[model samples]
Target: MSGPIHPPLCRVDQIMEVMQAAFDPAWGEAWNRRQIEDSLAMPNVFVLLVDSSGDLVNADAGASGLAAGFVLARHAPGEEELLLIAVRPEFRRRGIGEALIRQLAQDARARGAERIFLEMRENNPASSLYHKVGFEPIGRRKAYYLFADGTRMDAITFGLSI
Candidate 1:
C-alpha cells in the first residue's frame, strides 16, 4: 500500500525566486545562486521554505503551493545563526516571516542549539519582527554593511535563548 504523500521540502530555486522578489537591490542583502548552493552543501546548514499557508511546497510536484518565503540558518556548537530570510513582497505583513523564525527555532532546538542569533542592518524594518519573536539586541557592528553606492549601515545583532 502507498503511504500518504508529503509536500516536498523547499529548494534553492524556490528560495531564489523569493529572494528576487523580497529583497530591495539597494540593500544587497540577498544571496546569489552560487552562495545559496554552497551554503546548502554544508552539513550544518539548513533551510525551511513555506507557502502562504505556512506549509512546505514543491510547485513542480503540484503539492501544497508555491514557496512564499524561506529561512536559511547555520548551526554551531550550541548556537544557530539565522543567515537569511525573505518573503515575497506581496506576502509581507502576513505573519510569514514570524512563521519562518518560529519554525527555525523549533528546528534549531532539535539540532541541540541553545541559542539563536541573527544580524541585520540597523535600518531594516524587519527588526520589529525579530523583536516580536523574542529576539533581543545583543551587539552591533558599526559601518559593517557597505553598499555599492558607498553608503554604510550599522549591523545590529540580536539573540534569543532557545
Candidate 2:
C-alpha cells in the first residue's frame, strides 16, 4: 500500500535512529551523533519519510511509530545526491524504498537539478531498487566504505538524469 512521504521537519533525531539501525555495520559506517547534527545543520540537506500517525517511527521495535522508510539527500551545485535510503527490515519487499527514491528524484527536479546521484555498497541489497528506478552505475570508488567491523567495501556510484 502507498503512504504519504514528506520532508521531516522536527523528526531528525528519530530518523537518525532508524537510519543507524537499518544500515549494517559490516557494509558501511553508521552515522554518528555529530554527523547527524552537522547534516541537519546544512540547508542543502533534506530528510523525507513515511511517518506513522504523524510521529517518527522507531527502529528498535518492529511496531515503532516510525515505520516504513526514509530518504536523505543533499544538493551540490548542479546535482542532488541521495545520501541515504533505508526501509525497516520488516518493511522490505514493499515499494516504500522505491517511492522514497522517486520522491527524491522529483524533489531534485523541482529544485532545478538536472541529475540525481547516489552511491551504494557494491553488494547492497538496495542495489536492485536503485537499478529499477533508472539509476545506472557510472563510477566506482575502491574501498570507499569502512564498515564497523573494520572491513572495507567498494562503492558503486549511480546516476540518473532528470
Candidate 3:
C-alpha cells in the first residue's frame, strides 16, 4: 500500500525565490540558503509563506507555486522574534507584507508568545509597515550594522505585545 503524499510545512525554495527579488544587495540583509536551512532545523523556529493571493501556503494548497512573501521567526517562552520577513518587489504595497506579519503574530500567539521583537537597520523602508502593525521602537544600537563600503548604521529594535 502507498501512503498519502504530504507536502513540507515549509519550502526553502519558495523563500529563496522571494528573497532574491525582495532584498537589495547593498543592504546585505538577505540570509543565505544555509542560514535558512539551519534556522529551520531548529525546533523553536518556524517559517510562514504566502502566495500571491495572500493565502498561507501549506501542505494542502499551493505546494508548488512560488511564494510571494515569507516570514521566519523564532520562539522563546512568552516571546517570539521576527528574524526575517520579505516580499517580492513586485508584490510590495499590496498588503502581502502586512498579511505575513499578521499571520506570524497569530501563529506566535498560538504558540504561547505574548510579544514579538525585531531589529532593523536605520531608515529601513519597512519602518512604516512595522509602525502600522503596532510595533513600537523600544531601543536602538548605534553603528550596529556595518556595510561593505565601511558605512555604519544604527539598528532599531521594535517590540509588539500580542
Candidate 4:
C-alpha cells in the first residue's frame, strides 16, 4: 500500500475472489461466480476496481492483484447503476471503498452519463461513505433486502450526478 490504490481492471474470477472476501454468506448480498460471469457477458457492463496491493494476500493467493474492493456497474443511454461495490473485510476503511466510488464516478462521466445511481440495504454502514462522496438519498424501498435469518432491511437508493 505504498501509493494510491488504483484498482486495476480485472477479470470476473479475479473480481469474484474479492467479492468472496467482502461479503458473508449470511448477508445474502454477495453475487455468485456464475452471476458475475453472466454480468460480464452483457454489453455496457463492466468492472471498475481491483485491489492489487496484496495487503490481504496470503501464500495461496495468486498474483492477479486480487480485488480488495470493486465496483460492478452498467451504463445505459444517459445513466448508470452501481450494481455492487464491496471491500474485503481486512481492507475496509483503508480508503479502498472511497477510491472505488471516485473512480466509478469518473468512469460514468467518461461515458457521458448524466448521473449514477446505486441502492444498498438501509442498514449498511457505508451510507456515510456514499454521502461523503456527494451521493444524495433519492428514494427507498420498504424491506427490499431479505436475509436467511428472517430479517429484512429497506433498500436506500442514492444518486450522484456525474
TM-score: which candidate is best? 3
TM-score of each: 0.89, 0.80, 0.92, 0.83
Candidate 4 per-residue lDDT, tens place, 1-162, comes to 221222233356667877888777777888888788777777778676555453433223343555677788888989989999888888787788777778777777778888999999997888999998999999999988888888888999999998
Model 4 TM: 0.83
Question: What is the C-alpha lDDT profile of model 3 across 20-113, one tens digit per residue?
Answer: 8999999999999999888888888888787788877774543887779888898899999999999998888999899888888888888899
TM-score-superior candidate, 2 or 4: 4
Runs of candidate 3 with Cα error greater than 4 angstroms are 1-8, 60-62
Per-residue lDDT of candidate 1, residues 1-162 (tens digit): 011112233376788999999999878888999898888877778777788877756444655436788888988999999999899988989998998888888878878999999999998999999999999999999999999999998999999999
Total backbone collisions for each predicted model:
0, 2, 0, 0
Candidate 1, poorest ten consecutive residues by summed lDDT: 1-10
What TM-score quantifies how close candidate 1 is to the native fold? 0.89
RMSD of each: 4.3, 5.0, 4.7, 5.1
User: What's the C-alpha lDDT at position 19 in model 2?
Assistant: 75
Candidate 2 residue pairs that clash: 57-65, 57-66
CA displacement after TM-score superposition, residue 18 of candidate 1 (Å): 0.2
Candidate order by lDDT, decreasing, is 3, 1, 4, 2
Worst 10 contiguous positions by lDDT, candidate 4 = 1-10
Stretches off by above 4 angstroms in model 4 are 1-9, 52-65
